[model samples]
Target: RLAARSGLSVGRLKISVVTTAKYLIPSLLGEFCQAYPNIEPEFQIGNRAEIIQRLKQNLDDLYVFSNPPRELDITTDFLTKNPLVVIAKQGHPLKDKKSILWEELYGERLLMRENGSGTRYAIEAFFKENRIKMQNPITIASNEAIKESVMAGLGIAIISQHALNHMAPGNLIELPVHGFPIPNSWYWVLPKGKHVSNAAMAFREHVTQGLSHKKPNEHA
Candidate 1:
């Protein structure tokens, strides 16, 4: 409270976020820093499992992810949409189609993220809902790597739209999967009952104010 009341001398925060939000979250943090120029901010970028470990140790003021894990005793505020989309190399047979059925995807060799990735979970959940079984999927290391494999014509994959930054000119294209653009949102999560710092509290308010009206989950 003294640091916040002092209003410019000392404010610091620690934050950990999942990998896919690397580009967007940093920009938001930069905006927050402009108001508290001296705020010492620390960041860790990792996958979902790494983030869960960090949260267990209470490492950061906030944790961010697309799919919220229920195991954590945290309070989450929806920040923004993290829509998922299917992508394939340019000139793939489905490129010109506007709305391809999900069942149609079964015919194509699919590229997938590593076993523990959030994208993989999202993909699995979608398949499970429709009782669709995924055959052997080419396992890539990261979203960027998946894009690379797709560009090489390995197969198509679903990923957060933000990671589309990894695409090179005309190398890959978005395929219109019916009932796709999965309606998921990024959330700012803080463990309840933990000691919240003024800087951390301020940052929470900074983000929450913009999203107070959004529902916790998105739907079709």
Candidate 2:
């Protein structure tokens, strides 16, 4: 068949990812495409809930997540570390502080991702464990919006370090809050018992080999 003749070098590669992975997956995908110029990539970016819904429906060849859903019977490969850190506007009072306590955050306005976001879930669990109660936290849907709000002095937020990599210099700074960088990682998921296309297999190998060469923090 023509499909066999074209091989992995020419085919549709479908991938879906959580919004935070938007800052990371595109460039790697671009490199993959460069090596196989004839291949077409169908990339979808959504919040954790949306991506999970897509996964449930088996809509994509691969799915990327910082917080992989535990309820799903899927296979996950650890792609890279995605450390979540607290962030604030460049000139905030706590900017120069050291070993900031978790209780100190209680007095500050917390900016949160919308309902069903993986980042929000992780933050809420951490806060619950630490017995810190947020006061009327604001909910922003996208990472870009959250960063913008922080830059405008709206409030501090907890987000992946990868999100800050794409931001312009000198606009935002990570707060050295204790028990921070919530220890997260990106995962590549596949539905159980699903057939793996050659294109998908190739991409998985490309990502694994590519990321292996860089330091944990340099995955971006």
Candidate 3:
């Protein structure tokens, strides 16, 4: 009886997410909190492998990812589209070129996300399918760090456009590399056959309805 009352009186919504969704989910969560101010919202952010491990252990209420783990028994509800693109510091030689080729990007120094990152996986998949061996690339963990490095002209990187939205205008601009704007989405993920709490279920519905009203090409 007490637990039920607590669930109603002070709902707790726990969420886990890959870094790409880090920029968007918080704003949505903020809106949810206003409607349920007493609700305690907990968040866990990590690379794909770590987040999936927690899901295997049933650690939290919900999980978000851009690249869903294959062959895993999980319930996936598509939340929002996440566009991934290549970006470089403003004023780079390739900055002004509108029509660019993937082959051209190969010769330039590249920066990549750390291991087990969904962004890194997507980048690798692109290279694999094209049969292009990625030249020596620098690996950086933090999304912001990658942007900063690119701004310093350290190296260009493939990053989620969601992260790019938060950067100052003109500081980092998308490079129109071939086959870009890689189609990806943030998913409301759950462990298959596991019990989902009422609060989580409510938030899932909230997210679904909220996204349905959005334009197809809306920025994250």
Which of the numbered candidates is closest to the native, going by highest lDDT? Answer: 2
Model 3 spans with C-alpha error above 4 angstroms? 1-9, 212-220
lDDT (Cα atoms) of all candidates against the true structure = 0.75, 0.83, 0.80
Q: Which residue window of length 10 is worst by lDDT in model 3?
A: 1-10
lDDT of 3 at 203: 71
For 1-220, candidate 3 gives per-residue lDDT tens digits of 0112234446577889998777866766656776667879898999998898988888898899888886798988777888788898888788788778877877788988899999988888877887767888899998999999999989898888888876556788889887787777788888787787777776776666566665654455
Superpose all Cα atoms of candidate 1 onto the true structure and report the RMSD in Å to 1 decimal: 4.6
Between candidates 1 and 3, name the one with more favorable TM-score.
Answer: 3
lDDT of 2 by residue, 1-220 (tens): 0112235656688999998888777767767777767779899999899999999999999999988998999989888888889999998887788889867777778889999999888888877888777677899998888899999989899998889767546789999988887888899998889888888887787777667765755764
Residue 10 miss distance in model 2 (angstroms): 2.8
- Candidate 1 residue-wise lDDT, 1-220, digit = tens: 1122345447558888888877555655655777678888888988888888898898888788877787778878777777888888999887788789877878788888887677778888988887877777888868888888888888888888778643345688888988887777788877778877778777766665434433444111
Residue runs of model 1 more than 4 Å from their true location after superposition? 1-11, 165-168, 205-220
Q: What is the lDDT of residue 42 in candidate 3?
A: 92
Q: For every model shown, what is its TM-score relative to the native structure?
A: 0.84, 0.91, 0.89
Estimate the TM-score for candidate 3: 0.89
